[model samples]
Target: MLKHAPSSAWFRSALPVLVAWFSLSAGACGLYSLPPLEEQKARILSDQITLRALTAQAFLEAWGEPTYSHSEPMQFFPVASGNYIPRFRVPLGESPPGWDDSIVSEQALFLGYADRGELLGFLEKRLIYREHLPAEQIHAIAAQWKREELFKTRLEAPPARPPSP
Candidate 1:
């Protein structure tokens, strides 16, 4: 009569082979390292043609991470005014130009890929704009944001104590 092994013994004997197979398969499937960033960018650009609408999560998955991300409040002028004014314009009186007493603002997220020379803007987690800018322009935009952030930080910081003479 042939003798049968216990379940525990069979499991113990097969464990090492199973582990080796899983490890080898994982490595071959690229679980150990990420693909090149340039390849990811190319894929994103190509995929975007068919995927006109992309969510923030989808963007992160495809682009990995942005070089810089900035969130700013966006103000819209009433369409009935028949004219549109830039946001930078100072309000002549208490309210902004083309803006009524009730002001509406929406938060927008801007993602910059300096290396890829791409700028993407998202509104409410949905991509609203994409542009292929020159690297210099991308750098300039990043520098401008840095300056603004520094200025904001200084303004919020406590006043420095004057040194005694």
Candidate 2:
């Protein structure tokens, strides 16, 4: 007995058109990109990260720990609002319509300061120079902190060796 071929004439035509639609739809969403570490610095520095503006605790709470990405202040979504829209001005520019709706979650890479504000580092996007330090660096920092916990006071001048007569 010969098996009948399934009716795919409609499917064949719809598939390519559907694929094209999807491609166009994706392009509308904008290209997906994660910025490089160097660029990350530039990006954050462009935003500005300062010691006074952001504390270690603010970063820790925002991120998980003070990694290269934690030095800067990150505005995460689901609750990312720009500085509480003042009581007198019309919401314009950065606070555009659905500004909060656009973002998902933002994790920042740590970078130096710009002027006085908190710098929001770039998302490392480079293929070759995706600068991610080894886990040991993070581990070593933690280990050093643990050792410091044992310290109570400064060492007393290392026994003061006498000079030769």
Candidate 3:
């Protein structure tokens, strides 16, 4: 039998519990890293996937024909409504439009992905945004384009706090 080093004794002794813990956590991990919606859709359409794997046809069959079909290749769409937006992780909230804030508008990000030739997935969400554009329409549009181009951006989200006494 192989000898267990003292430092690694904890690991060996803990292996059974660790295995049990992992098995318990397996369910949560199932939904964590799904393939982006675009790729899954592409596979489905390409026939690498079939109706059984995805309920595409079943859904249509049950519900009747789809409302709309898309023609463009490798494109994604996000449709949303209302005043609440996603990516509003910052505590300060958004600043005036046309100025950089802790975040970008959900509309802009959604549109950007659709326009960028790919989308992570489709989401319907409420978005809140400033009403007035701080810059002229054309300039503002250009700035938004730049923001999309320079995608390495972040939004500040309020830290989760413990319930108050």
Regions of model 2 farther than 4 Å from truth? 1-100, 110-120, 124-165
Per-residue lDDT tens digits for candidate 2, residues 22-80, read 97555333344433335444543464432113333333433344433321223422212
TM-score of each: 0.47, 0.23, 0.22
Q: Best by lDDT, which number?
A: 1
Q: What's the TM for model 2?
A: 0.23
* CA RMSD of each candidate after superposition: 17.5, 16.9, 17.9
Summarize candidate 1's per-residue lDDT along 47-139 as a digit string, tens digits: 642111355555677766888887766553422242222232335554444454444357767788888887776555545456678888877
Better of 1 and 2 by lDDT: 1
Q: Model 3: runs farther than 4 Å from truth? A: 1-10, 16-24, 27-29, 50-165
**lDDT tens string, model 3, 42-128?**
654564532112233322333334322221111121113222223321225433233322322222222221221211112221112
lDDT of each: 0.59, 0.36, 0.33
Best prediction by TM-score: 1
Clashing pairs in 1: none
RMSD of 2: 16.9
